[model samples]
Target: MSAPRFGRITAGPAAPAGGEALSELLAGGGARVVRIASRGQVDPEGAWYDQAEDEFVLLLRGAARLGFADGTERSLAPGDWAVIPAHCRHRVAWTDPAGETLWFAVHLPPA
Candidate 1:
């Protein structure tokens, strides 16, 4: 057997200017956990993410907005969360420009 791992989710390096950084926390058994740090980054125009797995994301710091292909948007603040279905087209609409926006995300096998 292996020992358990431990660490703080909020502990990490700052994201680069006008960009975002991703850190994989765990992955196995068709699931993955990730930490995302964003610094005023937005998805490119006309671009969308159509992922193969369902994603559950929680905002841990700062603020953000998620845009969908249906022209709807969801605003997220600290402690807010959303579940994105697999293959659902979406994009990062906005993020706080003066501060870091941290997110905790889990990707699960498609159903």
Candidate 2:
């Protein structure tokens, strides 16, 4: 038997000339792993992410800002991470516009 293949997470779609770029790395068992490439992409006006599952996001490159429903916000740099509980209302406030901002997201069912 052969071992599973190895893939680079940094490999993503071509530079988004318009909107944000997204790629799913894995999905199963009530969980999903997604890679998001951003260049100043933010949640639409008056929009928020009210996911049914918890999410953990890691900043692999560039910088970003997260806004919570409670008015609190978080700034993330490379190597930073944030865990958002299920049903927590939040939205992306900012992403580095000068270069690529890569994010690794893990969505899991509630505990």
Candidate 3:
């Protein structure tokens, strides 16, 4: 027997929140892709991402800023991509206020 094959599909955009958006772009498999948006909101200190799953992200619109645990920061713009390792702590520092940011995120876990 063989596993079923999946095809390309559209994804749902995130709401007004500043979290990752899960969609059907990559579904029915171990991996998943989501569309996210940011509205320039900052989470409280100590709030970070330490998920066991690896995350790959791309900025499609507007500007994004990332703050790392090592006290380093970086800015991202449209067409920019970032790969965050599993268990890495990071946070969103800023976002373009003129408009919302369109981001695509993919989650990959150890096989």
TM-score of each: 0.96, 0.90, 0.76
Instruction: Give the candidate number with the greatest lDDT.
Output: 1
Clashing residue pairs for model 2: none
Give the alpha carbon lDDT tens digit for every residue of 1-111 in model 3.
868856532334544655444454655457787767666655566688787888898988778888888888889999899999998899887776656777788988655
* Model 1 accuracy (lDDT, Cα): 0.94
Clashes of each: 0, 0, 0
Q: How many backbone clashes does candidate 2 have?
A: 0
- Score each candidate by Cα lDDT: 0.94, 0.86, 0.73
Give per-model CA RMSD.
0.8, 1.8, 3.7
At residue 52, candidate 3 shows an lDDT of 81
Q: After superposition, how far is residue 89 of candidate 1 from its true place, in Å?
A: 0.2
Error of 1 at 84 (Å): 0.2
lDDT of 1 at 44: 85
lDDT of 1 by residue, 1-111 (tens): 979999998897778768899999999899999999999989987799999999999999999999999999999999999999999999999888899999999999776
Q: Residue 99 in candidate 1 has what lDDT? A: 94
Among all candidates shown, the one with the greatest TM-score:
1
